[model samples]
Target: MTTVSILPISDANGERIYRAIAPDKQSTGRTAGEALDALTAQLEGDEFNALLLI
Candidate 1:
């Protein structure tokens, strides 16, 4: 399984955001779940397959 890192951050205006970082990609969302979902989508299909071969 691939490992991802989720970090909570604040914008210049102090709005909360979540950032999800994978091996070679990153995504952000309003919440942690949203961030993870975005990252998952990015990792699906060809990208996911490539990771498995590594």
Candidate 2:
């Protein structure tokens, strides 16, 4: 299993932040969903897999 921790935010529900530890031993600690959403608008990408989301 992987480990993930969403960065603390002023309003969690308002913004979605997630951390994903990939199988390659690389980890991302903080990422904004809204930011990704915006990126998704310009580019194409796949879904993210996270061990724990909170």
Candidate 3:
């Protein structure tokens, strides 16, 4: 099983940002939900593996 963590970070303009982190995978977005959606799509190919999104 692989787990991805969504970290809340700050952007250059001091706005809220979200980043997803996993093995060989990374994604950034304006919101946490958006980041999660992007990460999910990226991991779609691993159909048999378990993924934990945090």
Between candidates 1 and 3, the one scoring higher on lDDT is 3
Please tell me which model should have the higher TM-score, number 2 or number 3. Answer: 3
In model 2, the Cα lDDT at residue 53 comes to 52
Q: Which sections of candidate 3 miss by over 4 Å?
A: 47-53
TM-score of each: 0.74, 0.25, 0.74
Query: Candidate 1, residues 1-54: lDDT per residue as tens digits?
Result: 566788899977899998888888988999888988788898867554333110
TM-score of 1: 0.74
Winning model by lDDT: 3
* Model 1: lDDT to the true structure: 0.77
Return the top candidate by TM-score: 1
- For lDDT, candidate 1 versus 2, the one ahead is 1
| Tens digits of per-residue lDDT for model 3, 1-54 | 667788999999999899987787878999887887787788866641645555
